[model samples]
Target: MVSVAYDGDEKTIVRRRFLISGIVQGVGFRPFVFRLACELGLSGWVRNIPAGVEMEVQGTAGALDAFQHAQAHDLPPLAVVTSSVVEDIPSIPERGFTILPSADGEKNIQVAPDSALCGDCLRELFDPADRRYRYPFITCTNCGPRYSIITAIPYDRPRTTMAGFPLCPDCQREYDDPLDRRFHAQPIACPACGPRLRLLDGAAEPVAERDDALTRAVELLRAGQILAVKGIGGYHLAVDACNPEAVRRLRERKKRDEKPFAVMAADLATARRLVVLENMEERLLTGPESPIVIARKAQNCPVSPLVAPANGWLGLMLPYAPIHHLLMRDHFQALVMTSGNVSDEPVAFEDNDALKRLSAIADYFLVHDRPIHIRSDDSVMRVFQGKPLFYRRARGYAPRAVRLPFKMPPLLAVGAELKGAVCLVQGEQAFLSQHIGDLQNSSTCDSFRHTIRHLSGILEITPQIVACDLHPDYLSSVHAAESGLPLTKVQHHHAHLAACMAENGLDGAVIGIIFDGTGLGTDGTIWGGEFLVGGYDGFRRAGNFLPVPLAGGDTAVREPWRMALAWLYRSLGKDAFDLDHPVARHLSDTEKGIFAAMLERGINAPLTSSCGRLFDAAAAVLDVRQAVSYDGQAAIELEALAEGAGVSGTYSFGIADGEPLVIDFTSLFTDLLADHAAGADTAAMAYRFHATVARAAVEACVRIAGQSGLDRVVLSGGVFQNRLLTEMVYTGLLDQGLQIFTHRLVPPNDGGIALGQAAIAGWQRGC
Candidate 1:
């Protein structure tokens, strides 16, 4: 029988089968389709099949058209429909719209990154008349956990950690009712059936439960106590940001020094008082991702100085978790929301493990009975020219598939050291894991392996190839060497170059100026600042920074003075010590003799073409910093010093001709010393140095382009993370009539290297 519908006397019958994919499951897509079908007065059915959401509608052609339009345009907030396949079908006899049970098939569905607490859920949470009032585990179709709670594919409740808790009658009605907002909301539960909340003392024993626990937590925070609070992804050690002693106590206890900690404000209005926000920053803060947005601090901000000492910017985010919302409802303006770990270790998520690891650091523990299947730290980002620049991609961003420009075989890329992450690819979609900390110790290395298995298990990908960095000493590289899959080694700078290309969706080669601290060059020396021309297939070195000695190897990184001495020796030979420079004055005659010998004979010192070392040298020479607590601290301080200096002049340098042209800064360094001798303003000199690097970068690109016939330029690597340097180089390139591209989807740092490695491996394998 043919189903027919009358639209104002125009009787028509048609049928179409639609296949929708990409973040379409676990996001109320079925419920949305049900409502849309009923609205258009059509008869149809939708269900979750492993290949994604599938539906067939039979109705008047006009009504079907309206259904299609609404389905494409009006979508639920968290749902993302990536691809749709439509086909003509014979008319079917159907009475009304319905949502059918999920059927088994080949698993190929994308899980949405965890979302922030939605407004509707928030309203029900706080309403006195609501059944789930003040429920910390309150959630609806629009918001709450997704990736972090899933245990397997198709994203059904039985495949999640929530399977243990069966639904109550009231919640089951909401779950089954087609008209209800939470229809098919897998994690929906009222207080009677949901995860239990409690407050534990220092020894991990419960002191209070339910509402009393929340009140006790609020009281502890008001008394300037640190609380280890379990969140969607993992645990966070939280304290009042306005309490100076509390912030300091956290820093001292956590063994974290100068790296700024992210703070969670009660709301956007409170965030405005903490930092200066533009439209883009504000939107990102309140967006579904709910990342910590780095922004310029307001004048005399009330946040404790210890929160971000010497930093003009602060990382601020609004409450994302429901417990966070309830805790900050009326008690505090802001709270320190740093990750739950010591300075070097990975964030702990398991209940007992967190208790053992963070018990000393946290005065009390606010926990719940729900199990977090995967631990993801809060994502962090900064706005660059009205675009989001990620520092860490996790929680709300990880595990979301990024489509490739072309199809490729399945591959797994173990990312580089320092800011570790991994990329898994199946055909055209790439799934990147959350930030996995530096792969320096067994703890983080375990986390690295665990992340790979977790992502692979959930996505059902059997990788044909494994990719890693060229440097063999890295734990990621070592792991790749042992993996049973075929291996591909990717050069560090080449990976950086290819990462920018893949991110911008460019096929051909462009000029790549890659700058960072240290990467293994093909010639067995340390390479960092490099200029290359090529695409994903291959690359040729086009230019490089002048080689300089790295005195004392790793020690030169922590103490800028050693790198400064090396730069001075390279520029002026042994006579550099006789000068009246601060760096020269730091060493006595005997020390100078020993260091000069080290530089001359290359004793325990390796040569490097690193722009990162140059930043440290410049900082030390300018007396801006003597030693750094972190890797990029010197450059960050230099950028801060140069900002608003109100000076505009660049130090000129020369480009020495060679097979790979070398950018020589001897003249620039000499002139900088000349200015330092005159006791000039340090800020002005700092600005000139930044301008000099920018100008040199532009000139070098022009020279490379003149010879290589490439007009497009991509600036990449860790050094470009500097807002000052990146803006200057990008603007300078734009003025040269060149197409410029930079990192947007992934970070410019090593965190994004795995994606590049995966792309390059795909081409090498002839994908």
Candidate 2:
């Protein structure tokens, strides 16, 4: 039943059929269209099609124009309209607007990412008179879980994790009411008919139930006990961040030594007390994709220093889930919330897995009945030059498609071995998986396979071609070779350059400065410091660092002193080791003798030109860090040490003219040693070193551009993760009047290489 108003003057009716795409399904787009049509007194119907939302409305021209305007401007908060088409059609006799059943067609719709609790939902959640008061899973149409719970297209409850929970009579009434906010909210739930919580001990025996469970969990946290709490995506091991003993105990049990842990603050005010936040950071903290923002820690911060140990910045995130908010508001100011896995394994998402894997670490478990169909980790970000930079993209910001420059054929791209994430490209969209941890671990490798299978199943993509790295020994490359499909092997640095080019929609050749830790070069040596001229089709190596032996191979990565010794040995003779450097003095005589013998014999020693290794060597020379606990640890510490030191001096490097230019840093190393002996401040030296590198990179790019007649520069590789280095290089290049392109949509690290592989495969196929 419906009502319509007619003006006294009979106006001619016109019909317009509209099709909308991009994040229009499962985000209340249909209900929004229905309400707008009814408000305008228009007739006809709207329905969900595989392409997007389709609507045919009949009304006066003036009313139709207003409806069209509202459709673009007054869209639902979560809806992202990438395209819209309006077609004129003959007017049809219709009395009222209706929502028809979904029709089958081509699937081109975008899936909405998970969102934080909205203000309206929060008000009802805390209100004493509301049916969902204090409910752990309170959600409405405006906000709730979306990507993690969804398993298929045309998102409905039956296709989501919520299918197991049937609505009660009250909830069903509200769901059927078009005017209600929960009209088609698939995850809508109330206390009467929703998930429940339980507190279990180490033996898996329930100690508390329902409301009492939360209260007991809070008590345990206050008493300095680690509790594994189940969340929307996976489990998090939480402890009061203010308690140093608790933080230390959790770190020791989890076997994570020096890596910084992300903390969840109760609100913005609480977070500000611990870290400095600007307007942009505050907005990102409270926005729908509430991600962990790396911010400089306040002096004498209230939280225990052990939370982030020697790091100058802390990774802080505001509570994104209702349960997290309730716990922080009712119990603690801030909590150390780290992944539930022991070390290198994937985050535990299932109850049985959490209990089994986390038994050795967590003292108790705050369990929930809701099931997680897919596991997603918390996204990590940092603000640099007033822009959001992603360190890890997951939970609240993944599964949403990145539109390609052109349509691509069906393909699969298995990413690099480190910081693994796979990609599936079909048509004009590329779907990248959430960050799967390093593939060195068997469990992480399993997670990689699971992600590929699940993503393929949901997207219904059957790959005709598979792409992978050129490294023969990489797990991803091996997997791609055995896939029983046509394969393409892409060079490591070429893929990095192509990824940036593809994301920016560039088709022609550009100068690429790709600096990273390690990649298998086509010539069979390790490549990290490289400059190239290329596009999606191919590339030619333009410049590279001077080759030096990595004394103990991977051992040089963990112990920066070994890299420092190698660099010093290469630049100067054995007499160089007699210098009064801290690293030289710290190494044992036996260790030094063995390293020298290995380098001389070229036994277990590989040639490398890695900028990352150079950073580690510099940090070790300056006595900043000798041993690392995680990847990029030495470089990260060096960057922190040089945060605000202003230095105008820069070292010089020689570029020998050849087919592939050789960049020699002998003068730079000589000047560094002289400065160290001259009693220069470590921070100032670190800053000068960074400036030298930036200057060298710009000099090389400028020369390459002059020789190759290419003005566009693409900066890729993991070394660009350093904000100071990236900004300096960008500003220097812009000063030379060069068009520079860097990563924005995808990561600059190995996590984004898969997209490049897929794009290259597509272009090679003549798509």
Candidate 3:
């Protein structure tokens, strides 16, 4: 057959020119168009224009139609084509598809942030003949320096940090080649031009050459020395986790106790020896983003006990940077890679700042010259089912926003206390902030403000309103006030429900069991273990655990016995305040009398329905733990001890006025006393208490579901991190034939608070 050419002299009508907006820059959009047009055998030219990307296609009717269809559904993974409008234009000569150099278009453009290095770049770094071989900052079109380098809109070399270093003649050639991956790659540079590294001792004087920084850092780490290494986002305090003394010293200097640290190993083979890896876990570990947390491990993994301590799992990430890769190549097996920060603050990034702030924690510094415009911590994740769930989103995973299942107006959300993160949503995309730490101290608050300003400047989004937690004490709420934007105070647990709904793509009303350590209650008290019934816009208090006294205020959280004392009063009245238990003997006679009087008089003792406190009470009852060395330690250890215990499944708590069955600790306490009297193992009782709580929670959920004509259950909040409780609740609900949705894209903890706040804001704005 003769080659059919509609643009030939036989017939030529008109071609349409189009402009695409919204996340159409720096995400391989132009390259995608080039490939698509070529595959469809269409004649077209696509290139980056200032505000967005522009394209002109000329072909037969079928070819043009096919291109349009593919454009709608077959876009790149990170591409968000918000609007694609076609305008009729004059026909030109038809030829092969081409990708042209970016031109100045009138529309405002936003470039994507830097990504982790790609596989091709890694291969080039190891190839001896390559000019970029062993270069620590090798980057290609697909990855490296985007968000951090770009100074303004229209992402090109002239407007980025790379502007300081002009490309060499050979690199310029690669930039001119349309078929090459490095073509139009803004951050691309050779060994002759990229950022340099240097090793410094504790005194801040040079200790090694630029090329020897990695080798020297490894040597120091192998010798059980702590090194502050500058990473793509921020500084990380690295040490050999296998050395318990080194880890303990680092922890002591950083003043971070019990909170598990993350680890980085050489490769997947090394990682597998430390933690169990499922199919999805393996993919996440080795994928381009290569985050540091996924796949729960055994508590006793041999590679590094200090990495997780008493915790069952350690967060792990592969080397995504050239420097990181080089460090893992020799000397050390695996290193503890925790954020380089003091307690209650963001990690330090700048060299001068690291030297001053990390002087006590890091024995040496592995410094680099590239300036970090924005600081991002490592993204943390966990595998649920076959998908990775985000705990902390930053580094390789952010700036590239998530598209909402529903469109939303521009809004900014100041997330809740603890594991704080921020969110900004415009149209279908939502940009989540890096892990902002807790909104308590001035340093964290300052970091949160700076990050917000930086991100807002890049996106050029002015929020119509600010959404925040209802808790008045949260620094996030105060910051929202300072922003001068109209504020929406979303209830804490409602946001939790909405987060679950948003992650699961659910819009309808359902029963949401929001069980966490704490949240400000609507009734002017502390509430956790709440059951809410509603969707994104609003929620109803369906049911909640019965309120009990919280003795000594926050002190009860540190000493489980105080909560146990409160439980004893609730379950057995004043007559049951026994001073003969194991916990009682530890308290002074005068202290015991003071606690008894305080509970009886309700002096500064607030009421709480927190399941976390209940767990503490259980811990005290079984003598598993009487006092916590860290926040949630008692409960965490209790769950850890419950491993391998047989489940009987028959357990009950007293029903109070047809509400959620109040788990009477007095009865549990009495049972424990009897068990002790009968010489029953405390381990078995601890396991039984966990199983009983699971059973009671399920029963309450089932009863509520039947009454409310709702079947779907949403499990949320920090308490769900207890793996045993999670597995039991999941298995029981599934067996009952009820569809259940839990956090998978985000965590069940407060780390997910930002997304939830975003969803509610969107729903309220009717976006």
Candidate 4:
């Protein structure tokens, strides 16, 4: 109906219609709107719709302007408005603001990422006078578990894991009150009607229940026992960080040797004692996401060094849940809260499954009745250049739609083999699944498939096209091939390029330096250290590390000595053994003969230009690490070793002639070996090796820019996750008058490959 704009004595009357989208549901957006309109003295009716919150406000022009201003600037703490459409409407004769029942239309609204407990909830949790005093699940509209508990959308109490727990009278009253913080909060609960905790023995027998469970679990932790604590997204293996023996025992059981454990401090003050918490790092620790932030360990830290053995850095986070708060406030200063799994498997989310899988690792199970609808691990990040550089995005930071630069067709990008994650694009928002973990075992592959299904089901999207990596053997790629949908295979390095482009909203071609461990090249070789020129449409490989025999192929990645031997053989031929290198000296005759045959005949060995292998080789030559217990251990230790050294020297490297220019490290190996021969400091040599890579990256970018005339360079791939190398390369590129972009929103590793693949596939024919 057309508005009567010129009604008698009502020229100032105005009706404003608004459709606010994105995370508007399940976050008290409707109540926020109701209160704002009432405060502005405007008559309006607000309600939830499938896509977002829809409302119409009728009042004087001045009051309408005030309402709009508040809506824009004064949003609920957890509400994120991706889009707001406001338009003129016919003046209604309504007398007061009202909240109507939800109206259904489209299922396009975003699911809120799981949020940390808010300040108000924390106050109520500890206050003896409050109804939810010391209640583990105490929550309000502003905080607590969100994406973890959600089953479907338009999110409502009936569509969550809490659906079985009918509200008690007190909670029901709060839920029905329009101005109450609990109004329409899907996970709202009271002590009488919410989930209860339980303590179980290794045999799955209940030892304690309800309030007594946590007390008993705390006692176990105090006695240096490991407990499997069920959290919002999944289970965490918790142990007292002050108990060195307990930390070592937990590490042995979890099979996570040498990897640093993430510790949880009771509060910000306790956190400051364990690590050097800068303002930004503190914000991340206590922010809405509450991710584990990697920072330098403070000198004279009280926590056991076994928590991060031989590492200068520590990953710390604050208690994000009332349960954690209570446990932390139980006199203990800190606890190691590591994912509940055997290092390579997905985190245990189901109670029976957690009990079965973690029985050997955990002394007891601290579980709850409320189920986690999806399995999400704790998000991991570090601050670099004043923005979050995600190491792993999950739990409190995931499943939120990443805004795309332009509208794209619905599609699925089933990501790479390691650091597996999936992305689903609908319209202009790409919903990336939580880090599904390395798709190494059957359980991880199952988790990957389930993640795709769960994400697609909740978002109400059926992909028209499926994108997978070019490697045919990957489970993700195999799954894509078996599915009855059209497929697009994206090259690994190119996907990294597109991911950087998509996250930064860049449209045209830019230079991308994607340095990782392994990706199947277009010509059937393994490509990792790559310099490409491209956008989402496609990329052209401009340069890469010089091809060398990857002795034993995948096996070389685990044994750094093998890569060192191969690089030495490539650079100095058979005479490399005369350099007194420990790698060659340590090898037995039979072992050297086997590796020599493999490299010369290419038996089980393949040509690779992986940057990760390069780091492994360097680490081996420097005697930093000869073998890795985990995926990136050698590289991680090398970075730590370099950082510990105060060296800032750069070794020499050169560019070679080829169709795609080669990043030749012949000179680097010679100089690095010279340092090894002279008995120079190992740490200093490691630092110089890293600096040489940064210099080589800059030189490659400079030459590539001259050929392509592209002024922007994006540094991506798993190698770029190294803070020392990233800062160096970023600064080096900037010095050459070239614009540099690095990952902030998404990871620079394979965890973010799905996003890049989805973006590139979105531009394909009829995608």
Q: Which 10 residues in a row give candidate 4 its minimum summed lDDT?
A: 1-10
- Residue 145, model 3: lDDT of 66
Every candidate's lDDT: 0.89, 0.87, 0.78, 0.89
Tens-place lDDT per residue, model 3, 1-767, is 01223544423344668788867777667877887887877787988876688888887666676677788888754466767787666778777888877787464445465576678888988899988888888887777767766666556788777788788888898877765677678778887877788899889999986678777777888888999988888899998878998999888988887778888877788888878888888888877677986556744565556666666667888887788887877556678888988877788977788899998888999988877777788888877666666767777666666656688877999889888888887776678777778877887888888878877777777788899998987899888877798788888898888888887878878899888878898788888878888888788787787778899898898899888878766666654455356666667878778878898898979988898998998788678788876677888888877765665543346545354435344466666656666777766777887777777677777777887889888999988877778778878877877789988766688877878888888888766
Give the least accurate 10-residue stretch of model 1, judged by summed lDDT: 1-10
RMSD to the true structure for each prediction, in A, is 2.5, 3.0, 4.0, 2.4
lDDT score of model 4? 0.89
Cα displacement (angstroms), candidate 1, residue 589, comes to: 4.1
Winner of 2 and 4 under lDDT:
4
In every candidate, how many clashes are there?
0, 0, 5, 0
* Tens-digit lDDT track of model 2 for 347-445: 999899899999999999998888888888998888866877778878787777777888889999998998888989999888888888888988888
Write candidate 1's Cα lDDT for 1-767 as tens digits. Answer: 12334456446688889988888887888998998888888888999988789999878788877887877788898988778888778987779988888888876767888999999998988999999999999998889998899898767789888998899999999988878988878888889898989999999888899999999999999999999999999999999999999999999999888888999999999999989999999999999899999999998799998998878899999999899999998888899999999888999899999999998899999999889989999998998878999888998998887777777898999989989999999878888899999999999999999899989998888899999999999999999999988999999999998888887887878899998998899888899889999888988888898988899998999999998888888889987989899898888999999999999999988988999998999999998887898779888988888996999998868898887999988778888899999988998999999999888888899989989999999878989889998899999999989999988888888988998899899988998
Runs off by more than 4 Å, candidate 2: 1-12
Give TM per candidate. 0.97, 0.97, 0.90, 0.97
At residue 459, give the lDDT of candidate 1.
89
Error of 3 at 23 (Å): 4.9
Tell me the lDDT of candidate 2: 0.87
Residue 15 of model 4 has an lDDT of 88
Candidate 1 stretches with Cα past 4 Å from truth are: 1-11, 104-106
